[model samples]
Target: MDIEKIAKAIEMDAGERLPDIRESLQEMVDGKAASVHTPEQLMLRTTRQKLGLSQSDFARLIRTPVTTLCDWEQGRFNPPGSLMCLVEIADKRPDVLRDVLM
Candidate 1:
């Protein structure tokens, strides 16, 4: 085939020949799901370290147990489905979320 014709064919068939983009999009979706954390979780996790609050204190502020927040941070398991929804909603309006949560 002529070089120009081959180039056109490659361009047209690239998605079929290269499925990596589909996988990349899926990975982004998964990361978004995994990265989410509740406003209370985010606020406590981000600030308590600076304030020198013990995990126990931070847990009380966030109304959760030390073990649960520890597990959330460590990726042992995610917050509950309802908390995920709050996280995602907060993420969409980060400025407002940060101000209110902080």
Candidate 2:
């Protein structure tokens, strides 16, 4: 598709514009960019990590099959809104879920 245009855009000089780009990139590499993502898309892996659970454990916690959880995390299929809401809740308040699980 527009390879030449893309190459040109990438080759453009960084003449003081966005001086923080290098620092920001390094911070992201070091897992310090906490505010990078928007609410429009929730990363399944990130949500799962926030719960401090392994894939198997997370699957069990949500009562979803491991294959389905894997598909959702790999982006093979987007989770339905109801499942998304549960994931978000687990991410934001693991204590609430832990009580229910117990």
Q: State TM-scores per candidate.
A: 0.34, 0.60
lDDT for each residue of candidate 2 in 1-102, tens digit (9 for 90 to 100): 454444345446543345455555566567784543334235567888887789899889889899988877766677788888876777788788788873
Q: Which ten residues in a row have the lowest lDDT in candidate 1?
A: 15-24
Q: Highest lDDT among the candidates is held by which one?
A: 2
**Candidate 2, TM-score vs. the true structure?**
0.60
State model 2's lDDT.
Answer: 0.70
Q: In model 2, which range of ten residues has the least summed lDDT? A: 33-42
**lDDT over C-alpha atoms for residue 98 of model 1:** 46
